[model samples]
Target chain A: MSDQVVSPRPGAQVQLEMAEQPEVLARIVGRRTELHELVRSRLPSRLRGISLIARGSSDNVAVHARYLLELATGLPVSLIAPSIITRYHHTPDSRDHLVVALSQSGKTPEIVDVARRLADGGGMVVAVTNDDDSPLAAAATVTLAVGTGRELAVPATKTVTGQLALVTLLAEAVGSSIAEYTGGESAWAALPDAAAQTLADERLLAEAVAVLQPRGTAIHLARGLTYCAALEGALKSKETSRRVHEGFSSADFLHGPLTVASDEVAVVAYGARGPVLADVAETARAAAELGSPVIGVGAPEVWNGVPGAIGLAVPQTLGEALAVIPLVIRGQQLAIATTLALGLDPDRPAGLNKVTATH
Target chain B: MSDQVVSPRPGAQVQLEMAEQPEVLARIVGRRTELHELVRSRLPSRLRGISLIARGSSDNVAVHARYLLELATGLPVSLIAPSIITRYHHTPDSRDHLVVALSQSGKTPEIVDVARRLADGGGMVVAVTNDDDSPLAAAATVTLAVGTGRELAVPATKTVTGQLALVTLLAEAVGSSIAEYTGGESAWAALPDAAAQTLADERLLAEAVAVLQPRGTAIHLARGLTYCAALEGALKSKETSRRVHEGFSSADFLHGPLTVASDEVAVVAYGARGPVLADVAETARAAAELGSPVIGVGAPEVWNGVPGAIGLAVPQTLGEALAVIPLVIRGQQLAIATTLALGLDPDRPAGLNKVTATH
Candidate 1:
């Protein structure tokens, strides 16, 4: 039951080589040309709205893309779950829409079905995936290969980051100037370095794990674009840690959720622009004063003065990169810790299947 | 810990009584008078888009309102959480939109502050609340009073139904003729009776409680407008039963969540128009066959053939009423049962508070 101890098996070196190497991930990244070509070749005659499909980590990518596209071009957008589209499989009469399907493996049956349904309905399908030859790619009218190299862990990391990059590029193609203004290209390029820096202090993260491991609930707060990142983080935490975690806007947290503060509670705040960051810090301070441990993730400007807080200096772009990795790592570690603590196997969460087919 | 002896808190009573029946809720039936008022009162002179601010049960109401308005007016609408609005308390310079805030008590401090902020920012504010004298009501430029009678329970029931009634009226006001076709008036009038009917068989619900009380995770599924009801139900169940319950569209559940189904899981399906109902029931049946207990809270047609399923018929209008009372009762009973089982007090959840305020 002791929370401290590192296991010897498939350590960070393997993850770094397989999941983080720029050259490895660059395979997916370099597919931007093919992706652009696929999208252009299958461009709709008229555009009314864009629909994005994904589930789990890929779903996070889809949501980010939706916001990025709207912010960039003020284009109308909708998110269609693969299950929904597949159930109603038919050619949509509307020719003025585009459907984008994202999956890392590109073999998920439902996603493949969704891509096919959209295409059959005469709607253009764009598949963003790591595997170019997977069913999703085959069904898609256009396939944007994410080339995230290989993901070995059951939980996704590099692929998720790659999906974010592809989404940013897609948003750029669709006329989102914010991507340009936000220095997304540089941010994307700096990911490997940023990720390396984040993992540099595994001991620091391990200490954080010690603080958080006992808690049953974690609250993640972020605003605007970063909110999506927080959501992805929370989801990973939930799936990996088996802990109840909710991702909400920092400002929103202050309104009501902060009342739950206790010494045992863990609050992770993603400091974003606007007064929300300050507000969340204040709430964290209040929680700390109440004996709760608050972990501040983001810039010092946002984390200053928070008591018993782990202030991780995550820049906006670096923040996005740093955010998902910790969550994945924490989730994996916690899953191991929890399983060992409960005398179970980390390899298998009870009653869970690797692939889900609704039919 | 014994399940057989559990009984409901005796005697049904009319909890809420509207003072002066607003014609909009009482007579107009399905008309969207409130929506029209919201649009006419708040929209920019040119009218382009809309954003909504609401929390708790009202948040669920806002989701439905957003969906209906989008379908009817084709206006881009987004739901802004009250926390987000309160976090960014500054007024926007643009007047091209409106922010509608809904609350039953209208005294929720955060909601009141958000309403004031929206009004101060020169954005049109519309308050849909039962208490006309509440702070939220006083802060709005135009307030639509839903004369839903007093609610005594901590969890909202009639107020939510009344709120939907008002939101539907608002949709009519905006010139959406869908209300007329909804058969809302007959449904509304039949609600009390339907609620009574559902409560008549306390044994059935109590048996359901036996199955649901022990579970740690639950998913509530529904489609279209009824999905909002499911969301509220899930929230109530979580808050009352002190369990982790997520509400999602029946269609959305099949995406990836289906992979985690087990015999011990509980799936509550709220059926409505379209294939979503059947799809969800099928999913539930598959889960049930796998050993999970499936609860259907809709028409029998949707629940047919699902083993160990409990069908609580709620006519569309009456559905909200029928579904909510039992939900509240079930939640309260579960809370009591779980509290006793876990040696905790039903009055307090660990690390949670009644009212949350920023430091």
Candidate 2:
């Protein structure tokens, strides 16, 4: 069962698109030299820091990138509030900053507007998207096309992984001491296989969904880089399954959100074997004690001997951050399986468009 | 009904602390010069930017500060992920950065660890806390006491507003051109009256609770500064009422969280008569059409003509960010009212402590 490759039933655009993550990640790895060269040419010569503007799934990718970039480069990275530009007509001091805008469609009005303002404020703007000719691209000093092709799914699975891959490559290229901190080059190179291993384990994900499908409300928890996975997972679940799914950092759950912990709410905790694993384990154990069913996704050590939790293994990786690549695939699969379980279309969630044009 | 300053039952420490907000805000405003001078002394001489680290209610205050500092000072602000220090054993370059840690007890382990590391990394550390001699204050270069006097409430109210006021003062002191944007001086002077006005209008909040108390799940929506209100509101509601209350930026709500909107989930939108008002209004209207009961908190113009929403007026302020001082009080009041309606103690929520010490 561990070595078997199971494919989800075809014709669901979201499932098909999500399945492309491994191949797309491999292509990004293979073309790293070219991508790096392109990035070097477009980046501001005197860039001191990086700021990102994004929303929804793209924003989750940006969050993952924030941890990746700062850990690798030791430079400050900020997620800019785009309303300061689009709503307030105010632009911060952007000089010597590399402002990156991420969107699948590149047509989100506020993001495009933010990119234009950043570029106008003398910051170098880079657009990462599937569309090469998107308005976001035109508004930026440089465009790094995600190369996921046109995504038909409203939830954005493939383009998200593609954007994450591109950011990893960018961190590897620009970071002065990435190898000293993270084996950035090798980890990016290893992403393809990790993603493949994750996608190959469709049975584990289906089993997880079988445990989770009956719950009407769920809380997804993770720490650091994987925290973004929990957020993206909750977003996918809420939109696709039409259920109440909230995501919080595992540490934060103990603070106050734990009051919502009860038998009625299921808990999903993403555990990487790291310093924070203890905190995550404690949270899961506490939630289980409170009678909530818990799903533990990571190494067996994280969930071993814990009462009332179903455990799934995380793909092997160099560091906890790199493990996010495979961890999120499980999230994507869980969303898809849950949608199917609810007899809903994962590709077209009700009242959702591929491009959320907000200003 | 409009002018009566009704108080919650005396025994509940949370209600008593919540009632302290108006007076605490006035004290912070009146002592602006001394607070500003203390901040100036502790702030790094060549501070390039600001970074904040906190968790739980303190983290929410930090979010509000991020908005305040960035808008008032035009400086890049980043919320440091505490796990990067506590779990990953990594600290990004902190030289030329001003790191601020907010806590009511000044004893949260992760936050204290983050402050110690930042100070060790050559960054200036400032502790904004209610306890002046707690470990967090001892680890910092300077401590600005919130002066709320040992809050017995598990959910922060007075200390939260005190932290926000201190950040506003810090921003005013450091900002080069704050007068060109927000009338920072006048607004600080006006906060006391605005807060008193807000607290005096208890009937409006009670009416809001009456409409919202029946719902089992809810979404709180706001944009920009008010978005922090929504988040704090959700936290207070989750801890006190034990109901599922999620918060989102109005624009981001339009992106995905809106899918959870239904007749069963009440929607609360914080609207101000400002540039982003239209977007917030649109979201309320959209949620209402989806059959969710909408509670609009702000100017009458925002929800007066909109269908399926009850309007509660916000106290007038010089700018939207300053408006948050009064806006969030309504949220705290609503949480208290909802908790009382549920026959729960607002002070001692089950399974929660005053200070959550996490690794």
Give me the candidate number with maximum TM-score. 2
lDDT of model 1, residue B175: 38
Across all models, the iRMS values in order are 5.6, 1.3
Error of 2 at A4 (Å): 33
**Residue pairs with backbone overlap in model 2:** none
Q: What tens-digit string does per-residue lDDT give for candidate 1 at A145-214?
A: 6665555444466677667667766766665255433345565566555555544534445556666677
* Candidate 1 lDDT tens digits, B236-262: 565545455666666445543443456
lDDT of 2 by residue, B197-229 (tens): 877777566677877788777888888766787
> Candidate 2 chain A: worst 10 consecutive residues by lDDT?
A1-10
What is the DockQ of the complex in model 1? Answer: 0.18
Residue A10, candidate 2: how far off, in angstroms? 11
- In terms of docking quality, model 2 is medium
